[model samples]
Target: MNDVTSGPDTPPLTKALKETAHRLGADLVSVAPADRWSEPPSFDTSTVHVYPHSGYTPSELMPSTHSVVVVAVRHLDGVIDSTTTDTKTTAIQGNFGYVLLNRKLNDITFGLAHWLEEQGYRSVPLGSAGQSRYNHRADDDPDILSVGYGVFSLKRAAVLAGLGRKAKNGVVASPELGVRMRLGALLTVARLESGPLLEGDPCPPDCTICMKACPTRAISLGGRVSHLRCFTDVGRRGVRYEEIKAKFKAQYPVDLPDVDYVDKEYWGNEGTGNRMCKIACVAFCPLGKRRLPDVMRRVKEFEQQRPKVELLSFPPSHEFALDAVGEGNSAAEPSGSG
Candidate 1:
């Protein structure tokens, strides 16, 4: 509530808070200003209902002023080892670390929120929609991925939250856990000071192993992602929803309550279960420099789908690959390559 920093006499409060956060089970912790996660920087109103076209202004979402607390969870051992017989269990084991991590952070965040509230400051969790009277929508969209303060998109947010960096695979790579981490955020009404965005780029300029491994050629040279293509591939392969429900039905049914319709659409796989694109894209990226499991390869063959590309790079970020191979509305004559 107090915008003023704790004086020299109270400098340890922030330090204590950080220590408390870790003790409460946060693998990584960082402070972010509430305004940074406001809509304008992240959303497209034309496409999403929650935010305005320029971005979602805080006043439009929450009139009251405040701060934010960002948190991250690292992956656990045995989570990423593809050789594990139960692929479904293995995936959950991988992602559950973050889930548990978030749960712990929520407990601490609310305690911090309460403390701030007692000090006359307002506070809320990063993804606190539906939790209380002041909750807002947990609307993280594909187009506007960076709803919180961080670099790049969600992948980078995880990294900035101190989880890791963009792997040659495009996934966030953690130093302690490698590329095994999930990201989360907590918006608080309190006015805690925000953390510095890390300096020194962790991504490598020479590495493009993830690109080489993609099946659909969906990942561009600039690191931009194609959600539709990735999801389609995931659904068809029975890894996204079907895999989760099949393996963890007893513990974690794939029925996502808030997003059932969207999940079904994605799980439909557009009537095809051939998720070669995602398997290729994620399997081959060198971030963490890991190899694709044999199951992924066997499934690719079973689907009878062969990708036309062996090795390729996206044209300049602005150019379209289709333009080189097909006729278009432009008046220019067709090129020989097309």
Candidate 2:
């Protein structure tokens, strides 16, 4: 697979499509085979109760779905850092990584899907963009046709795509971008090359910053998150750090755990509105906090504070991201990321 055979192995079309994704501003691009979704989802019902929206498999949506292409792009920095505050206007007020980023990601998938179709492969873009393009009648809803369909879950698709591991915060945390990212997908019959799953834990051992920082206490230690609390509470009322801080202090431990508060970036100007969650999980997480060197330094610090769990670096960095994909003996692209 690493040899780039481009015929029955690497496939030139796969490489070309990946390059196209990069050119479209995608930070990471990976693929997952259709069979992956066909398998029964395996997870502990006791600790993990999340049933991602719909349960439809890729094959059910598109019978000939040979591969699923997943792509991720970063939001403007500082959105995650704003988790300490109740209001996060930095992202809502027309920031590149907010609504605009989602739209752009949709565009990328739509374009890729169109490209796949041109190559005689059927593809369906998964996102909210223009529905009219795929609909024959104006009253028709592309909900299951053109919109984000065919995948069981986008986050899981991202994990399968080999971009990164799913973090404790419930979002797919990329080594390069952390949780402050927008993900998009395209279901295609084309068997594009895939990447490997990122190895190791994204969070440093003993570092439960995200679970601890959650304003609503929605995230559990066992990784079960209350999506209702996160979306409803945070979106409707906003997240206030003082509330989270007070709760933590009330349940004080031998020594108060160190909680880092980062400055919220207001690229769209400060105090826009307190509509969304400040994204506390992303704010305190050490991953993607800085460049690789800076992130490594923090990991070393964590290793000292908590010696039980070993701390390490997130692999498939920019230097090796391209190479990481298509590395295994199966396809030119990675089976997962790192």
Candidate 3:
């Protein structure tokens, strides 16, 4: 978080910042030049609108943003894979799990921003939650094309920051964690050396696990994601919860006036049945096969007492996790002399 400008001392300072990020609970961290935003987005953004306003750029977001720091937090080993019909277990994995994890990740980014400001550099922290608003649609076609509202693309920023690559499922795939991680970003005025993008594809060309596992056929073999389909399927519970709430309000205008109507299916009950939504694509990926045994063991233990939801299928590993990337780690290392 040093307020050093672009110079010979910048690299060491960048290394220190990365080390600080790790110490702040980030599983992975990388720095990208603000200029990376200049390139056209991989996904079609022509129809999308960034929040607070559209047309906001890296320069506009921080005016003097010279670098963007991207960070990732690994999901607990068995959390995502432990599917269960038990409302409590499902709620833990589906609804509240991501909400809690995202909050933690956002806090980490805010901490980094605070540290940067303490060092005399201004920073803007982008939280892991509430980034998506809606799907942008063309007036003529009436079909959703891209995100209608957002600030910045965390997945894209993560890629440019050398944290990971994009999988066919439209999620960022980390070399160490596959798609089992959430991302957060910070834009700063500090001029730090940029990290290179991680080499190689985390998703194999022949592997279509995510595409096959998607219940809505939202993912394609060519890497295109149907935003509409994906959102509709995942948001089913939320939609139904809203409908039920409306009905209850209409029928019981005066009963339990102060009590809030809760949806156990959507949010779970007292954290015992909090289910978010299914993430079959994420769970079925072969990249994290090494963690599968542990995941299954936990699933067995949980299902022994309660029936767990069944998965579509868990495929065998097509390649070792190491084989997805080059031999050396692309992550930023701490400077020995810093």
Candidate 4:
């Protein structure tokens, strides 16, 4: 049986579930059979490359997993249309407002999981790399932590669930929202009928506009992206972002002048290096209305001036695969060290 199907009918429960997701603020919702994680269609390596999986399936999180309920929420207009350096720490990285969108999508995931549980089905809410506790004997491994674990690839799950086409810029581009969407999922024991993959690719053939627009040169052909360079561009390479922010808040006295424009040495007295990138990937996408024409033009111009340095993928992903599941590894073993 195919993991994704083009069935002419949606099952009754699946139909009601879609309505519930929308009512709870999900802009898009679809299902992929749990087994889809095990065998990607035609063994497409692109899906596995960016949203990689060393074979962690929904069943790792939910032993009885039957379907993965993928959900997405479009990014706010204020975030998508902001200037390259719109202040206030940008929320996403050094200069992006990604938190607002994440909160909404996570809420939808939480809501759907709760709804499924009420229906007597086991459900695990996968909001931004859901956690799974690991078995740890204090006698043998007293330092092992069971919390803050994250693994399930939400992007890969979105692709499997038929949310959007994985575009050249390395982001899934939905028909209505382009790449301006955040994703979350629910692993449920309920057997929801799956949706077929989106019908067509939004990216044009021979078009490498997004690749050219990237200042860090992170994205390559076929969606192979360098997570290291992408993270490094925003100064997310060696430091914990939340820790830096906390330090900034703890040290700065509100009465100080020009608090917002303090140099990295002042606010980030601990040598917190924070930089930003114009979201050229989304802004330059020739897709939906989310693409800001003026921003695209600026990005194109900046592309020519910026230095091009290629980057490689980081922290080999295989260690997180569920093959280690009953062998004592969490499906979410450990987040790759940035």
lDDT computed for candidate 3: 0.57
- Candidate 1 per-residue lDDT, tens place, 111-158, comes to 665655665556554431211110012122224221122211334334
Which wins on lDDT, candidate 1 or candidate 4?
Answer: 4
The segments of candidate 1 whose C-alpha lies over 4 angstroms from its true place after superposition are 1-6, 34-66, 83-108, 118-120, 128-179, 234-338
Expressed as tens digits, the lDDT of each residue in 238-267 for candidate 4 is: 334334323333433222244433232211
Candidate 2 Cα outliers beyond 4 Å, as residue runs: 1-10, 40-54, 78-95, 128-152, 232-273, 289-338
State residue 95's C-alpha deviation in candidate 2, in Å.
4.9
Query: Which candidate's TM-score is highest?
Result: 3
Query: How far off is residue 117 in model 1, in Å?
Result: 3.4
Ranking by TM-score: 3, 4, 2, 1
What's the count of clashing pairs in each model shown?
22, 19, 12, 3
The candidate, 3 or 4, that scores higher on TM-score is 3
lDDT of 2 by residue, 124-165 (tens): 887522111111221132122111212246776777667777
Candidate 4 CA-lDDT value: 0.58
- Candidate 3 least-lDDT 10 residues: 313-322
Q: How should the candidates be ordered by lDDT, best one leading?
A: 4, 3, 2, 1
**How much does candidate 2 score in TM-score?**
0.60
Candidate 2, lDDT over the whole model? 0.52
Error of 1 at 307 (Å): 7.8
Model 1 — TM-score against the truth?
0.52
